[model samples]
Target: MDWLLKATTPAEKILVMFVAILLFAGVMAFILYVSEKLPRWIPAVGFLLPAVIMLAFGLLWPGLRTIFDSFRDAAGRKSVGVDNYVTVLTNPDFQIILLNTLAWVVAVPLLSTVFGLLYAVLVDRTRFEKLAKTLIFLPMAISMVGASIIWKFVYQYKPATANQTGFANQILVWLGLPPQQFLLNPPWNTGFLIVIMIWIQTGFAMTILSASIKAIPDEITEAAQIDGAGSLSTFFNITVPSIRPALIVVITTIAMATLKIFDIVRTATGGQFQTSVIANEFYSQKFSQGNNGIAATLAVILFVLVIPIVIYNVRQMRISEGER
Candidate 1:
C-alpha cells in the first residue's frame, strides 16, 4: 500500500488504475459472456476462423500463387508462359533433383516401413519388448536438425594417413580399407541421407504396426495354429493381412514426409554433391537465388505431389473404418 501510494505523478496513478480497471472489466465481461452476452459461435469462430483464414492465406493462396508463378520468368517480372516449368522439367540438374526425390520417395518409405513392420513383429512377444521399442523409437524424438548433426559427425571426412574420425571411415580403417567420405559421393551419398530419414521414421511405423499387430485377435493366431499353419505361414497369412490398413497408413505417411524432406539434406550436405531435392531446391531458388518463379514452380510441384497421396490416405482410412 505504501509502494502504491508512492507514485508522485498523477499519470502513473491513472495508468495503473486503467490497467486494473481493464482487468476487472475483462473478468466481468468473460463471466457475462459465459452467462448470456456472447453468441454460441463467438468462441468457435474466434479460434477456428483464424485457423481457417490462415489455411487459406498460408497454404491455399500460396499454393495457387505458386502455380501461377510457375508460368513466369526467373525475375518474376513477365509472364513466360510455361517457360519456367519447361526449364525446370528439362534442365539436367533439375532432372537429377527430380530423380533423387523420386528415389527418396520410393526407397525411404518402403525400406523404413518394412524394417519397422518386421522389427515390431520380432519384438512383440518378448519380455524386453517395451524396452526394445523404446530404444528403436528413441530417434524419432530427435529433431531432423539434431539427427542431421549427429549423422554429420558420424559421416565427417578426414584426409588419408590421418587418424580417421568419421564412424564410417573409422570402421573402414579398422577393416584395413581406405577411409571414405560418406557425404561427398554422388548417388550413394543420397542414400546416406535417406538412411537418416529411415532411422527417424522407422519408430513411427513400428509403433503403428505394433498396435495393429496387438489388435490382431488372439483367437486368430490360435486358429492358425489349429489349422497346422507354420509360424511363417501364420504370420504371412494372418499378421500381414490384418495390419494392411496400418501398413498403408505408415507407408503413405512416410511417403508424404519423404517428399518434404529438406532439413536432412540441408544440414548434412547443404544440398550439395547433386543431392538437392525439390524441397531444398525450392528454398535455394526463392530465398538464396532470388528466383521466385522457379521456386514457386518447385512449390507447386510439391503441392501436386502431396495432395493426391493425402486424398488416398484419407480414403484408405475411411475404407478401413468401414471394414471394422
Candidate 2:
C-alpha cells in the first residue's frame, strides 16, 4: 500500500494501477461466487455494494469536504463562517466575475441556439446539407482548449502599421481601420470569449434541434401547406411549436456548459483582462492565490447555480417523454 501510494516512476505507477485493477476484479469475482448461495435480495445488495462504496468515497466525501472547507479561512486552519461567501458576493472584483458569468450564461445559449436553429432550418433537406453541417460541426470535434487556441490566434493583435497575422486583424487592416485588442479590452473582451463557446456549442444545438425538427410529422406540415400557411408562417406556427421541448433542452444544456466555462477563458486570456468566470476564478483562488476558503465557496456557488438548471432540464425532458 505504501509502495502504491508513493509510486514515483511511470513503471511503478502502472504496476500499482494494474495491481489495484486485479484486486478489484478478484473481489468482484469472490462476491459473485458467494452470491450464488445467497438469498435473492442479498444478490442485488452484493452487486450494488461496491458501486455505493465507490460513490461515497469518491463523490460524497469530496463534495462534503469542499462544503466544509468553504467555511474555513484562507489558510484553512481557522473557522471563518460565511466570510468567504460575503467577500465573493460583496467584493467589486467578484461582482464583475459574477456579471461576466451571467453574460456568458445568457449570451452563449441564446445565440448558439438561434444560430443553430436557423442553420438547421436552412439546410434541412438541401443538396449540400451534409457538407454545410460538417463545416460547422467540425469545431465540435476539436477539444475546447484546441478551439480556444485557434481563436486566440484569430483574435491576436498587432500594431496598426505592422503586418497583421491574425485573420480578424488582417481583415481590419484591409478596411484601413486600427487593430483592436480583442482579448485586452474589458466587457467586450468577454463577448469575444463567449463567441468561442458559441462556436463550439452551436454544432451541438444544431444536431439536436435538427433531429427534433425532422421528427415533426410530415402530415402536420403538409396540412399547414394545404391551408394558407406560407413557409415563414409554417415555420413559426408549426416548426417552432413542435420543437419547443428540444429548444428548452438545448438552451438549458448550453447554459449549464456556459456556466462551467473555464478552458476558453483560461487558454485565451488566462482569465486576465477582467474576463474571469466562477470556474476559472475558483481555480485561480485555490491554486494560484492559495485561498482555499474562497475557492470552496465559489465551487459551492457554482454547484448551487447548476442545480436549478439541471432540475429544469430534467423536468423538461420528463415532460417531453410523457408527451411522447
Candidate 3:
C-alpha cells in the first residue's frame, strides 16, 4: 500500500501503470466472457452498466448533493431552507456579481461576434486573406489565463512620476496625460476584464462565422450584385440571413463561456475590486470564504442560467436541421 502511494522510481511507476492496465483488461475480458454465456440481455446490460454507473456517480449524485447542500447550513449540520438563496439574491456583493455577469454575457458575445463577422467579411477572398484571418484567430489559441496575463500587462497602471512599465499608462505618459488604475477601479474594472474575454473569444466567433460565410453560395452574392445590391446591402440582406443559424450558435456558446468565466477573473483580479461574477463568487464562497451554503446557491443559480441557453441552442439546431 505504501509502495502504491509512492513509486520512487520512474520504472516503478511505469510498472505500476502497466499492472493496472493489465488488470483492467483482464476484468473487461472476464466480464465479456461471462456475459456471452449469459442471456442476450446480459451483454447489453454489461455494455450499459459502466456508463450508467459513471453518470450516476459523477453527475447525478453530485448534482443532487449540491442541490441538497443549498438547503442546508454552512456546516451541513442543519437545514436552512431558502435562506441561502435569499441571501445570494439580496446580498449587495452577490447582486453586483450577478450584474457584472449579466453585462459580461450581454457585451462579450455581441461585440465579439460583431468584430469577428466584420473581420471575416473584410478578408473574405482578398490577397493575404489567409494570413489576415490567421492573425485574428491566433488569440483563440491562447488559454484564458494566458490571455488575461497578456492583457493584465496591457492594462497595467503606474504612478505618473514612475517610469511606466504598463503599455496603457506609458501611452498616457507619452501623450502627456495622467496614468489611471485600470483594474483597481470597480465597475469599470469589470468592463476592462470583459474586454479580455472578448479579445480571446472573438477568434472563436470569427472561425465559425467565416466557415458559415464561405458556405453561403457565391451565386447568390453575384445575383445580388447584378441586382444593383451594394456590398453592405448584400451582407445585410443575403449573407446575414444565410448565416443566422451559425450566428445564434456562436452567440449562445460565447454566452455560456462568459457565464462560466472563472479563470480570467480569478487569475487577473482575484475577484476583488467589485469585479467578481457568479463563477468567481462561487469559487470564493466555496474555497476562500468557506460559505458552502452560499456556494451551492450560486452554483444552482449558474445552472439555472445555463439551462435556458442550452435548450434554446438545441431547439435552434433542430430547427436548422429540419429546414435543411
Candidate 4:
C-alpha cells in the first residue's frame, strides 16, 4: 500500500500499472466465469457492476463534491451559501470573461462552419481536391496548445524600430504600419484568440460536412441543375437542405469545443488583457487566486451551460436517425 501510495521510478510505475491491469482483468474474468453458473441476470449484473462503480467514484462522486464545495468558502472550511456564485456572476472582470466566452462560442462555430461548408462544396470533386483538403485539415492534426504556440509566434509583436518577425506584424511593417501587440490588446484580443480556434476547428467541420455533402444523393443535385438552378441556388436549396442534420452536428460539436476552450487562451495570453474565458477563468480562480469556492462555482456554471447543448445534440441525433 505504501509503495502504491508513493511515487516510484518509471520502471516500477510501469510494473505496478501492468500488475494492476492484469489483476483487474483476472478478477473480472473470474466473476464472469462464476456468473455463468448462476442465473443469466447475474452475468448482466457482473458486466455492469464495474462500470457503475467506476462512474460512481470517478464522475458522480466528484461532481457532487464539487457542487458541494461550490457552496463552501475559498478555504473550504466555512459554508457561504450562494456567495461564490453571486460574486462570479456579478464581478466586472468575470463579466468580461463571460462576454468573451459568449463571443468565442458564437463566432468560432459560425465562421468555422461557414468556411468549412464553402470549402467542402468548392473542392468536392475538383482537381487537386485531396491536396486542398489536406492543407486545410493540417491544422486539425496539431494540438490546441501547439496551434496556439505556432500562432503566438505569428501574432508576436516588436517595436517599429526593430524588424518584425511575426507574420501579421511583418505584413504590417511591409505595409508601412506600426507593429501591434495582438494578444495584449483588450476587448479585441479575444477575437484574435477565437480566430485560432476557428482555424483549428474548421478542418474538423470540413471533414464532417464534406462527408455529409458527399452523402447527398446525386439525383437530387442533378434535378436541381436540370430545373435551371444556378450554383448558389442549388447549394442553398438542395445541398444545404440535404445536409441539415450534419450541419446541426457540426455546429453543436464546435460550440461544445468552443465552450471549453482553455489551452489556446492559456498558451497565448495567459488569460490576461481581458482575454479570459470561463475555462481559463476556472484555472485562474482555482490555482492562481486560490478561490476554491469560486472555482467550483465556475465549474458548475460550465457544466450547466454544456447540459443544454448535449441534450439538444442527443435529440437532434435521434430525430435524424428517425428521419433516416
Candidate 5:
C-alpha cells in the first residue's frame, strides 16, 4: 500500500499502472461472468455497479474532499471555517482576479461569437468561402499553448531604439509610435490575453454558426428579398433568427470555455501583472503559493459560477431538440 503511493521512478510508475489495468480487467471479466449467471434485472445492476463505483471514487470523492479542504487552514490542520471564502471574495488582490475573470467571461464569448457570425455571414456563399473559413479556423486547430506562444511573439516588446521583432510593435514603429509593453501592464495585459482566447474561440463559433446559417432555407431569404429587404435587413431579421439556438449554444459554450481558461494566461503572461483568471489563480494558489485552502475555495467558486451557464446551455439544447 505504501509502495502504491511512492512510485516516483518511471519504471515503478509504469509497473503500478500496469498492475492497476490488470486488476481492472480481471474485475471486469469476473463481473461479466457473474452477470451472465445472474437474473436479467440483476445483470443490469451488475453491469452498472462498476461504473457507479468508479464515478463515486473518481468524481464524487474528489469533489467532496475539495469542498472539505476549502474549510481548512493553509496548513490543512486547523479549521478556518469560511475565512478562505471570505478572503477570496473581499480581498483587493483576489477581487482583481475576479474582475479579470469577469472581463474574460464577458469579452471573449461576445467578441468571438460576433466576429464568427459576421465572418460566417460574409463568406456564406462566396467563391473563397472554404479558404476564408479555414484561415479563421486554423487557430482553433492549434493548441492554446501554441496559439499563446504565437501571440506572445506578436506582442513582444523591445526598446524603441532597437529593431522590433513583434508584429504588433512593428506596426506601431512603422507608424512612428513607441513599442508598448503588452504583457507587463495591468488591466490592458488582461485584455491582450483575452484577445488570444477570442482568436482561438472565434473559429469554433464560426464553424458552428456557419453550419447553422447554411441550414437556413433559401425560401425564407428569397421571401425577404421579395419584400424589398436589404442585405442587412435580411441578415438581421431572417438569418439571425434562423440560427438563434446555435447562437445560444455557441455563446454559452464559449462562455464556459472562457471561464476555465488557463493555458493562454499561463503561457502568455504567467498570470502575473493582474492578468490572472480563476483557473490560473487556482493553480498559483495551490502550487506556487502553497495555499491549499484558498485554492480549494477558488475551485469551488469556479464550479458554482459555471453551473448556471451549463444549466442554461443544457436547457437551450433540450429546447432546440424539442423544437426539432
Candidate 6:
C-alpha cells in the first residue's frame, strides 16, 4: 500500500484512486440493494440492468465501434471500406488462424461428445457409476488455465539426447522411441491442444448424456432385449438414436467453447509455432499490437462462426423439448 502511494504520481494516483473507490462503492451498493433489499421485480431489473448496461458499454458499443473501425485505415482516421475484411480473408497467417479455428470447431466437440456419450452409456447403470463419472468429470471442475498448466507438464519437452521426462515422452522412451516435443510441432500440436479441450469437455458431455441415457425408458431397453437385440445392437439402434438430440446439444455446446479456446493455446505455446487461432490473434491484434480494427474484424468473424452453432443448438433443444 505504501509502495503504491510512493510510486504513484500524486495527481494521477489520488484522482484515479478516488474515482476507482467511488465506482467500487457505487457498484457494491447497487449489488447489495438488488440482491438483498430490492423487491422481486425490482431486483430482477436491478440484476439485469447492469448486464444490459454492461452489454451496451462493453460488448455492444465495442462491436459497433469495431464494425465502424473495420472500415477505417490503420490510424482509424480514414475509411478503407472493405479492404480490411478482404485482407483478413486473404492474409496467410490469418488464414491459418481461420483454419485452426475450423479445426477446433470440428474436432474438439465431435471427439468430446462421442467419448462422453460412450462413457456415459457404459457407466450409467454400473455398480461403480458414481466413481467412474466423478473421475472423468473432475477435469470439468478445473479452470482452463489450471488444466493448461497440468497438460503443459504432460506434454513437456527436452532437446534430443536429454533425458525424456514429459509424461507422454517418457512413455515413448520406455518403448525405445526418441523424446519428442509434443507442443512445439506444427499442425499436430493443434491436435494435442484439442486433446486437452476434449479431456476437459468429455465429462460435461458425459454427465448430460448419462442423464439422457438413464431417461431412456427401461421398457424400451427391456423390449429390445426381449426382441433378441444384443447389447451392442441395442446401444447402436436404440440408445444412440434415442439420445441423438442430447448428443446434438453436447456437440454444439462443445463446438462453441472450442472456437474461443484462447487459454489452451495462449498458456501452452503463446501462439507460437503456427499454432495461433482466432481468439489469440484477436488479443494480439487489439491489445498487443493495438490494431483495434483488425481485432474487431476477427471478433466479427468469430461471431459469425458461432451464430450457426447456436441456432443449431436451439433447434436441437426445441426438438428435445417436443419429444418430451
4 or 5, greater by lDDT: 5
lDDT of 1 by residue, 1-324 (tens): 543556567887887787789987886566556646456766665445556987999988877787888888887789989878888899999999999999999999999999999999899899999999999999999999999999999888788878877898888888988888788889999999999999999999999999999999999999999999998999899999999999999999999999999999999899999999999999999889999899989988898999999999999999999997
> Mind giving the per-residue lDDT tens digits that candidate 5 earns over 1-324?
665779988988998999999999999899899999987598998889888999999999999999999999986888898999999999999999999999999999999999999999989899999999999999988999999999999999999989999999999999989899999998799888888999999999999999999999899999999999999999999999999999999999999999999999898888888899899999999999999999999999999999999999999999999999
Report RMSD for candidate 2.
2.1
TM-score on alpha carbons, each prediction: 0.87, 0.93, 0.92, 0.94, 0.91, 0.86
lDDT of each: 0.90, 0.95, 0.92, 0.93, 0.94, 0.87
What would the per-residue lDDT of candidate 4 be over residues 196-253, giving only the tens digit for each residue?
9999999999999999999988999999899999999999999999899999999999
Q: Model 4 compared with the native: what TM-score?
A: 0.94
All candidates in order of TM-score, best leading: 4, 2, 3, 5, 1, 6
- Candidate 2: misplaced stretches above 4 Å? 1-24
lDDT of 2 by residue, 1-324 (tens): 677889988999999999999999999999999898897698988899999999999999999999999999998999998999999999999999999999999999999999999999999999999999999899999999999999999999989877998999999898988999999999899999999999999999999999999999999999999998999999999999999999999999999989999999999999999999999999999999999999999999999999999999999999999998
Model 1, runs deviating above 4 Å: 1-47
State which candidate has the highest TM-score: 4
What are the RMSD figures for all models against the true structure? 6.7, 2.1, 2.2, 1.8, 2.8, 4.6
Q: How many backbone clashes does candidate 2 have?
A: 0
Query: In lDDT terms, how accurate is model 5?
Result: 0.94
Deviation from native of the Cα of residue 216 in model 3, angstroms: 0.7
Give the alpha carbon lDDT tens digit for every residue of 104-220 in model 3: 999999999999999888878899988888888898888888999999999887778888998988988899999989999988999999999989888899999999999998899
